[model samples]
Target chain A: MKLTDLVSRELVNLHLQGSTRDEILREMADVLAANGRLLDKDAYLDAVFAREQEGSTGIGFGIAIPHGKSAAVKTPSVAFGKKPEGVDWNSLDGEPAHLVFLLAVPETAEGNEHLKILQMLSRKLIDDEFRQGLLQAANVDEVMALLETVE
Target chain B: MISMKLLAVTSCPNGIAHTYMAAEKLSKAAEAMGVDMKVETQGSIGVENELTAEEIAAADGIIIAADKTVDKSRFVGKRLLEVAVSDGIRRPEELIRAFSEGDVPVYGQGQADAGSRLKTIQEIKQARKSRQNPVYRHLMNGVSYMIPFVVVGGLLIALSLGFGGHPTAHGMAVTPGSFWDHVLQVGTASFSFMVPILAGFIAVSIADRPGLVPGMIGGYIAANGSFYGSTAGAGFLGGIVAGFLAGYVAKWIKTWKVPQMIQPIMPILIIPILSSAVVAAIFIWIIGHPIAIVFSDLQSWLQSMQGASKVVLALILGAMISFDMGGPVNKVAFLFGAAMIQSGQYFIMGPIAVAICIPPLGMGLATFIGRRRYTKDERDAGKAAFAMGLVGITEGAIPFAAADPLRVIPSIMIGSMCGSVIAMLSGVTDHVPHGGPVVAVVRAVDNVPMFFVAILVGIVITALIVNLLKKEIPADEETEGVA
Candidate 1:
């Protein structure tokens, strides 16, 4: 239920290397795959892209929450990526996304668990302090430390 | 004395993003103004942080900003301001100011009206200015009530088919005197009340509680033209007339200046009696015959269509379903399909079901096929959209289409149209009121393979067309976070 439990050190990228949206999503999905949250990287990535075709999850304020509820996900999880150079997320406000969270939930996630996570994160995301902490974090541990302060 | 604490509730239709945003704005404004408050949000997951009965009692005022219904029985005696959820977002401080100025009206002693109509001349003017939204609102009010009946009744009948029905020449028929027969009967019983309740609520929405009796009466008459010695009863179309006519009549009567002594009895006696009589007379003479002709013509036209002609109808419905992605137009199309289910025209819904799933499914597939066009974040979101679309949640495509409505809308509409036409052409039939291959694979749909094929073809078309239309991803823009 906690976002920390769903997000892992392996999935958190302190410095994003991808210049394009596709590269960032692939790198982050690979991170999730490495962390054992994804069963099939290709299937999961397809789901992620499919979700984007529906709408950009770049909800504004330099953030993008790229998420999918797919059978390829082993667990409900979130992967974080930081892009100081920013990436085109085609956000609601047409701003590029800087802080990216790739959320994956099982197709059978009981009672829309992903949406609940998104809502919980949305409130925290609205706070200036939380974004400041995440942006200023240096390492994986530092990111974890910042995420722990979600409440 | 210091101002007493106030409480508010905010909700919108989706109840996810906007509802929370509104709640946040309202509570933040309240806190900044040094007022003690609690804000409850009715969201997709349901009510959060509900107000206690004691809290309702202790509150000095309440603001109910909602697009959907919010039960106010608990706040019966409180000073309340009821407005659209937009007010909670855009004018939260202004709403709080009204409470500070003690301008809101107290409810539960009588009707819990939104605000008092203290002015006479301006009241009519105020009413006219608000008319545009009210007509649509009133119709939605009727549709809202009518939907529960349709969904539950239709589903129960579907369940009856799944559990207790065997196919006849026309469709599934429950065995006489069996338990499934009883279930089917119950569902039929529910459907029987659909028009009356729809008419009743629309009138109540328009004319308040006084419209209830006359509206129901007029609706009952409309639904059963035997009262006027007509062979074919006026259908839902007639119900609309009855509801609006009764509502306006009751509303007009409320504008009358009865003597002070007669005012007490006016609402209970004179208004209901006069309006009911007038509505009945008008409906029997003027409305019923004309609407009956139109309704039957429509029913027959729909019923008689076949082959290519049927596909045309299916195409229009499919496009409508995917056009706004569950907005008002989509709801109207859905309601049309549901009405068909009640009349035992299962094939129309067959196509609608296919159309409903294609937008999300096709959009999801588009991301998969054209990976180079989308950003890394988008591709990931596409996976989720694909999954949601598979399960028949059309909203999965919303985020994508909302951002680029021009290309996305046309693409999804075409995809849905292709799927719908295919479903109709393939002779697919859906017994259940709901859509998607989920329903079909579960045996709620007839010709399951064809249904799957229709969905598949539509998804391919959508994915191909959209990916073809999509431009290459834009370079990153300047970020906006101070952090």
Candidate 2:
């Protein structure tokens, strides 16, 4: 229902260090794995890449929501990663993605609750200040504080 | 006087979270500004807290903070400001203060947005660079313009005949030297104007302003047939050829590099003159008689359809009318039926009218009778769709088709086909070019009982079939939806 419920401070990275799009997806997937959200890290990464092949999750506005609905995911969760230098995520507008919301939904998540979380993030990202605040956040606490206002 | 009431709409992607966030932010900002504000949210679920017509009418300034396309048709003639939903979240004060600032541009006043047109211009340039199908676009433009004229002409003639004329050897005849006779005469005159308007606007759609004169001239010639010294002109078929010829010739002339002094007069003088001459010459010398021959022959063939053949024709026409649900195929079939009305073949249009209402009315009924088969958004849409069907608009079924085309399309098509076939078999005849019970109530239809029966049966069949085909959402979600 709210970002704080799906997103944790441990998964919010103020500075995401990755060059290529795939590496960034893997890094974000690893965040979920480290937080015990995924049962298998490699499988989730593979699912994310498979979904990317259908179309880039880069939904323009310098934002990419790379997500996978896979059995590897043990729970529905979100991992926030901000790339300061921006990566070419093959976006709709061909712009570099500075803000990334990695969505992981369990294969059996019939409620589509993870999709709802993605909806919340996607809606707020339309606000330039929210994106800017999240991007400008000094640490995980600042990121968590901004996301708390999502409800 | 500044009107304190404000309306705002928020949307972005399919996510539910951000929409509420922005709405919360805007309401607070509106409160601070002493503005009575109501925010509407369009999310994955559906439109929540829709603005009533009264609220929309009473509101002084409107703000549309949407990241997706919102139909701005209703907001026409309103002082409106639209910004990204993010703007509402980030800069609400700036958006609200714009009402007092008087810098907000009025939207939907029959003008394209200045900034948005920049995209259209760029896209047009890109399209021209590739030379994509402008022909289809121009033809559709002609059809759109032609429709209103056809409706006016068709209904007037139908009403005049129904009220004032008796059955005659040839169609119906108004009483000589009576008030009914004058109404019939005026109605016939309106019908005669239909062809030229169709041709003129088709050309307008094709070559912009310059093609209008030539297209209209060509259409008049096509309709009269006497310009080419032939009887029965070419009918709507000839008008189509004339429209295309005039549009293209005008478009060709526009491409020529003229001197700067003469360029100013090209659209006003040179292009129209040259194009009209070309269209006249070609229609008279090359294509005019052949088109008239074909039109007349086809008109005779349609008038002769009887029994099983008529039922077959109605079935085909019905399926075509419902198949695309107001796409190119539907328009072509509708145009054919309207053109048939001009030729005094009322039965050809009878089934088409019935088919038109079946889809909308059926879909609406389906939602009501089989409530579990739809989500909450669909049930809400169902009410509007049903009402649209009563007035004979087929496009009301579009959302269901869009949601699940494979199932919805076939169901609606079957229902429309059955209705059309039954209407034809029962000898239902509509004089008016329009469909639905509203038109029938005005004595536009003969065999009115069968007409109603055909429509009711068709609506029921469509509702049953579509509901059976559609999978139900979890029932718990309905409770959640209300919550």
Candidate 3:
């Protein structure tokens, strides 16, 4: 159920180039797909868009957790992207999200372990100190180390 | 020890991050505020940390934050705040603070009329936990349990008489040894259990299992006129006396420092026997005769009222029936009407029939016309109340009165009084023991048109007066948890 177990160095992007919400989502989804966590990027993106339509995943504090549970997902995994320039996410606080965690969970995921990890991530994001740590982390290794502390 | 406890439910359309996030944030906020809170998360993994009935009953307030539909029925009678899931996450402290500020609306007001019977009973029991004296609490516990028996007996008796009884010079009477006669007997059997069950449960609430035998035995003695040397039995009032006496006597015996050998047998053998004997003896020798005398005297006084002004009698009966809506006062008025029917004074029962239906009918109309004054739940209950009123079930108004006694009780009392006065003035006569339009349909009522007119006037008065007295439900409460 550890957040570190759902993410890796290859999934971490310190400099995300997306200038808009859709571009950020696509960039992060590509990271998940390249890491062999998604079978069909288009289908997974559709699920994320559908979730966004109900309510935005941008839960203020400069954070957005855009997630999708679809059969197109190959494995339960998370892609971390930092857009320091900030992107509009329709957040409750009306702040652009600088830290984004694109979560991919398979429709046929075997157990609740991945969901529990997602819960831990959601809770950790609420902590001001933890968000600061995520924002200040220098590299992929630093990001992984900080996420491991969530357990 | 925490004085306040809160229950919360969190759900989202995606059933993943938001559900758990809201739960976590709420939990953290409650902890920081030093209030006990339990959050049930309806997430992707299904419901976790689900609240139990006992916990829900004991909670001071509730918060429901969900993007998707969540059942609010279970939180009936609780001070509740509902908001979007995003508000739950971003403003958890503010949500909990609403309860402290006492701004939250009580959820499911008047829902007892539309909700499940068991849930209504449970809500009543929970509501009784606060601001009630120990004696009142114990007595109410007994009454709550005794209500079903009373309704069953009352409805069955009404059914048998309505369907099979023939009006004669004496009164309504069923054929001897017939199906309806057996049904009447069955109804009587259920009525016989009412007092005993009331006493037994009261004792149980006070002294636990050891008090049951004595309470029931004492109640039986109280209800039997032979032991008390009067024509009338002691009735429910005397039953209450017996229950308290037996309960306290049993509780007192448990405090005695007995030998080890006898201590083990005290609850099962010694306590039951001694308490039962003590209660039975006390009632038979001291209080029972007085109670029976009062009961009989009250009956005689009511009978004597026949020659007096019918308006005054109708006014008194109407006030009593609507005052508590199936409580002790209501029972007295109802029994008086039933007794009058036995004496072939059908006109006395006529006003009672009208009075009995007015409270429910009036409350139903109040909700209908004053939609802004009542919550959605109350409006739903109003529909059920209207249906019950048609069938003469006065208990349908219990939820409305319970929810807002100040406005609702006075309005219903005035309504019943108006209806009863009209029925008396018109000389409406009811042959059967039942009230409502159903009795008229069964050909048991004379001047059916007047009976309906009385009810209609009463209903309108209640609706208008209650609406005038009650403030409108705030716009936020009416909105529910909008996404």
Candidate 4:
């Protein structure tokens, strides 16, 4: 239920090469697939797209958490993508996003478990040091290690 | 030689946006025409930059531009020009020119004969007031009663899902025989009355007691599509049409010759029957097919839309949510999502959920990120609105939009629409009728992470747009030197 348990080094994309929201989502879906955490990339993408329709997960402060629960997911997992050049995500403060957290949860997980993970991630992200460390994290391993501290 | 100052006042019902816009335009136009004008804006907190009694007494002319009632007793003895707020917004220059050309007439004095225009304005007001037939009054009454049903039904359905439903292999399903299931159904039944109530009231307003029977019957037909060859029928919109048809039919029938002794019975029997017959016939034969086609097309379009299709959908939902805040436009979108939930399409509600929260959430975030863009009152209201957004309340954004509609509406719309599209493209599905961050947290959202992302994106977009759009008031202007 926690970020450290749900996220792995393989799930992190250090540099997102895509320019558009779709390309980023596709790349994120692929990461979930590569980690064996997703059964169907298409379904996972559908879940992601569906969630986006409700509203952006960007709660502001240059951080975005995009998460979904779908049958396409083989297991509950989290994928971290950092866009240094800052994609035009239209952040609340008019700032481009530097840290992106894409969470892919199993469709059947207990509702409380999902909330626990979001609470953990949101609380930690609000801290200046925690977000700064995550932003400066040189690689996926560093990001994963930092997330483990929260766990 | 004697000279006099010209004073003008502008106001609208809500006392925001249009009121200020009209004031600004009028002031600018008056200045250009060399008219010494001091315009006061009556907004939510009452009047701002008020004119003194001496100034009013010295004015040779006065213009009152308002939709709501303005106290004209103060200017009764002066040369006054009265016009609708729309005329001020659309024709400020012409209004000023008319005043300069001495076209406005004096009132409340021996010179009343000199101001023919004043008599015409009075006649117009009288005509407008007299034109309000019983049908309009009854319709408004019905609508007033009906809104609570829609809100309660929609909110209860959403709450039931949030508290009771669990994700299943076949998507979200309520367990059979659950307490919440009963509650949910009860809520849905309340919503079912929305159309009937709307139509019935409109008729009652128009024709008084005579309009009630036909209105209710017409409303029933509108709600039930089997009579019209459609599955969903015309919904609330159909109710409106039915109400009008029934009212007019009943009114027409009232003119028929009956025994003078039976005149009282005519309203109870003949009018209701004739009106109901007309409404039923129209729905079954004339209007049914087109309404069915439109309803089916809407369903098909929603079902067929995929990934990229969300962008357009988001734009529309966002526009609706922000257009009038919680007014008719917002109701239309909200009702569309609720209807879709009954039809087992959860994805259509996805974008709507996102659109509903973005306005308040985004404004709340703006207050935290930047303090200069908002007034003290706005920042305070933003805090409360933020909490409202978590519960998926769209009315929370009304205060901000009212304060600066031109700038705020567009900002929230762009943000909300962007978030909505992203949610759609992400394939997020919401089984519930209502939306909010709280709903997502309660496992009401299918794609939890994408729900977060969608909200985050929306918050960012709204904040950015609002910040960018806000015109900064200079700091120096805030502090004036004191000797």
Candidate 5:
């Protein structure tokens, strides 16, 4: 349930080049699939889209957390993506999102595993310094090392 | 000598919160801007601070900020400013300034050349015409009265299942010839009228008295799927369609002029017959078939989902339940689960039950764990929401979500979805058409131990996530101003 245990270097897209919301989601799903952590890319995409239809996961403060529990997921994982120019997420504060957390939980995990991961991420995201550090990290390895302290 | 008066009306959905908020804001803004104004509030109890007919006659302009219908025929000859209730809440100062500056235009029959009065009159007329149509006025009147039935019926059935029904090998059932069976049946029968009433009022709102028969018949067909080909028929949504169909049909039929001898009969007889046939045919052939197909497909898809697939399903449901905190999307997911309960699939309800409690319980727990993160209004609502959550009322989370949708929605969704997945994996099931811990306590849920576990886990997850997501409240601000 640790942040590092769930996120991989390959899954981290430090520079996302998408302009629209759907494109960003597609790009994030691609990163997870490329890392061999997903069973079906389409299914994972469907799960993300389905969650979005319910409401945007953008929890304000220039942050968007798009997560879903899907059978396509081989294991629970988190993908961190930073948009340097910021993406319009229709945030409550009406600010573009600079930091995106894409959480992929295995559909069958038991004993509150996903919950534990979510709690860790939510806590860390609230701190301005932690958020700044995550956004300012030079590369994926630096970001991964920073996340290690969360657990 | 030149003289003019301005009259204004304000309203909101809940009538208590936003209504007063808008009224207070508008009053303050108008006073500061130095404008002559008399405001009337049409709230839940009824319209207060009566606006006299003389006031309407003399007023050069009118401002209406309301979600519900406001009678505008009285202001048919005046200038008006019409805007959403949110405008009043967020931009009252600007709105008042615009009105005082004569920025709005004249509308309706009062377009005479007072030259200076032209702009003010035009604005008032535009506001009045766009407020709420006569049809919507009547329809809302009916919906307002009809909501109590839906709430009462839904709650009663939930209560019966939770307290009186026992889990049999077949499913959750009340013992034959038992008193509880009658009570549950009565509650269900009350619910049966929901669709008919919805349609009837919609028609009555549109075509006055003549549209009733056609509307009711249309609603009945909409709710009963035998008319089409699906076992699972349309519910309240269909009622809305039927109401509009019947109203328009009746209106169209009434316009056909017959011989002088048959004129009276035409209003009573011909209109009803023609409108009913049109409504019934549309439901049976056009609208009914497509709706039936979709309903059946949804049912089959739900039934076909297996163990792992169920987890994915749970996550989607949980996320939706917590998303808007009882807004349209939340209602859709909740209603879908409730509909499935009548068809003997309790598993779908299991995840819903867990999801419902997450937001309130989570937020409530946050207050205890991190008191500095929430305002006093939120903290107070948190306690009540937690209690409501224990009984499975998802609406308990509305205050928090409304206050901060971005942070609160995702936090709650993640926690609730996690709980839903766990419940689904455990094979928990619920038999009632409602959710909440209250339903489970009454024996409505299958595998009671798992149900309790699911709810407990969901609550814990939500609390943890919320506490983590939120920043501590600033210590400098007084807690009394938190709301």
Candidate 6:
């Protein structure tokens, strides 16, 4: 039930190297694939892009949450990627996204614990202090500690 | 300010993130602002922390942050602020501040929270008003205002007569200058205002404030038959007529395109004076003549029925008593029986006695039988009607008659006629001028058992028929009665 349970050290990137929105999504999707959370990387990326086509996942205030519920996903997982220099993801407020949370939800998922944790993260992102903590986190342990309070 | 509470409902199309996010943001903002608040979240997991009716009713304001449709019927009378889900997340404090600043619109007052804003409150009210039968709407408005006066007057008189009255040769009477006597007079005073208030408010519903003076003045004339050189006033029926007369007259005068200088004083000065004079003249001269003629004609008709069959006579007497419910027609029949009691015809008084109590008793039973057919106030009035019927106060049925005259009047009339026929055929005889089982209790009636049987049959007939004729009042239509 803990938010840390859905997120692992392997998926946490303190410094994202991607300069564009496409490169950042590919990098985050690669992290989920590397952790064996996705069965097919291309199909998962297609779902994410379809969601983006419907509406931008960039929700202003230096945050972008690109989520996809597809059959390619084998397990529910969250990949956290932070860029010191923000990237433009066509956010609502037209601000660059500094904090990126990539969510992978299986189309036929078994439990809703990860979804609940995602909801918690969505709610917490509205708080300036929580976003500040995410941006200033020095290492994966510090980031995990901050996210530990979400659940 | 510390006691204030806010209620909110948040929803979205996806229902996973935005719903809870908006709810969380609003909750956090409320916490920071030190406002007690509850947010009902309608998310993918389904409704959680649902707001209760009590909480919604007690809330100072409500916030509806939804991207999808949210049913707002439950929040009818509450102050509400509606915004998109994104606004709820980004501007939670601002939304709460709208409540603190009292900038929220009351739901059902022709205003919504977000889009589809109504142009003006008056336009919406007028639109709603026009949807119903205007006359029925106006009459209902009058009845709502008139109910309190009826309840207070009926209950007070019933108490005074039941507890402190003695069975007298004339009727039940309390000792002079006693506490019960004072209470009785106070009850009479309350009753005196019943017709005038009914008329005044009916006009208020029709022509607004300008119609009040004329309506009340016309009602005063209607209630006092002496103005028209008649013995009894026209009663609640007459009050209804006067109310419409004054209302339309005032409404007509309001339409005149008068000069700018005169327009300011029109509602206060010109409209009331002119309408009052017109309604008073019309009631006193035009309506009064017909009422007097009807009273005298009924008096002679009853006199001519002296040699008629006993069953036919009982039927006529019962019909008269319940027809207008203490109005002109009722008064004529009652006086004839009282006069006959002076002539040693005790049997004539028996049927009259049974008929007198049937309307109120039947209505009271009807309310009990069909709870959904009457409003909360009417159900309360029903209980009081029973007590008043026991004490032989015919005016107890006036509220019911005034409310649904067509159906209720016919139903009560049939019940009274049946009871009257039963009392007559069973050879029941009442020595006192009064009516009801109370007279039999005081040893004023012969064949006491049959007297009760007559009343029971009448009550059953009325309760069954009225319930059959009436439809169930819709839940939305059961707004809390003004009374």
Q: Ranking under DockQ, best-scoring first?
A: 3, 6, 1, 2, 5, 4
Q: For residues B1-483, write the lDDT of model 1, one tens digit per residue.
A: 246598999886545454665687787778888888799889776789988655775688999988788866456667899987757765788888898888998865234234333323233222222333567657656655665564455556656756676544333467999998988889778766766776787888788888988888887887776766654455555676788888999999999998999999988999999999999999777776665565455445544543347868898889978876654346556666777777888888899889888987887788888877775545655675665565455655654664456788899999899999989998898876667666665566888888999999998998888888888642321111000
Query: For each candidate, what is the lDDT?
Result: 0.73, 0.73, 0.81, 0.69, 0.70, 0.87
Residue by residue across A77-102, what tens digits does model 5's lDDT show? 78889998999987545788998888
lDDT-based ranking, best first? 6, 3, 2, 1, 5, 4
Number of the top TM-score candidate: 6
Complex DockQ per candidate: 0.08, 0.06, 0.51, 0.01, 0.01, 0.32
Q: How many steric overlaps are in each model, in order?
A: 26, 3, 0, 61, 20, 0
**Residues B246-336, model 2: lDDT tens digits:** 9888989999999999998898889989999999999887876665565455455544544347878898788878876654356556767
- The native-contact fractions of the candidates, in order shown, are 0.12, 0.09, 0.64, 0.00, 0.00, 0.45
Model 4's CAPRI class is: incorrect
Residue A56 lDDT in model 2?
Answer: 67
Superior by TM-score: candidate 2 or candidate 6: 6
Candidate 4 accuracy as TM-score: 0.40
Off by over 4 Å in 3: B1-4, B108-483
Instruction: State, as a TM-score between 0 and 1, how close model 5 is to the true structure.
Output: 0.42
In candidate 6 the C-alpha lDDT for residue B84 amounts to: 85
Model 4: per-residue lDDT, tens digit, B163-231? Answer: 776654333456778988987798678767767776777777566678888888888888777887776
TM-score of 2: 0.36
lDDT of 3 by residue, B338-431 (tens): 8788877888889999999898889889989888887666676677677668767776676566445688899999999999999999989888
> Which residue pairs clash in candidate 6?
none
Residue lDDT tens for model 6, B1-483:
455699899987656677887898899889988999899989877788998755775789899998788866557677888888778877888999898887788887333333223223332233234345779878888888988888889889988887888777687889999999999999989899889988988998889899899988988899989999899899999999999999999999999999999999998999999999999999888999899999999999999998999999999999999998778999999989988988889899899999999999999999998989997889988998988899888888888888889999999999999999999999898888888878887888999999999999998999899999999875544544522
TM-score computed on alpha carbons, candidate 3:
0.49
Task: Report how far off residue B440 is in candidate 3 (Å).
Answer: 40
Indicate whether candidate 2 or candidate 3 has the larger DockQ.
3
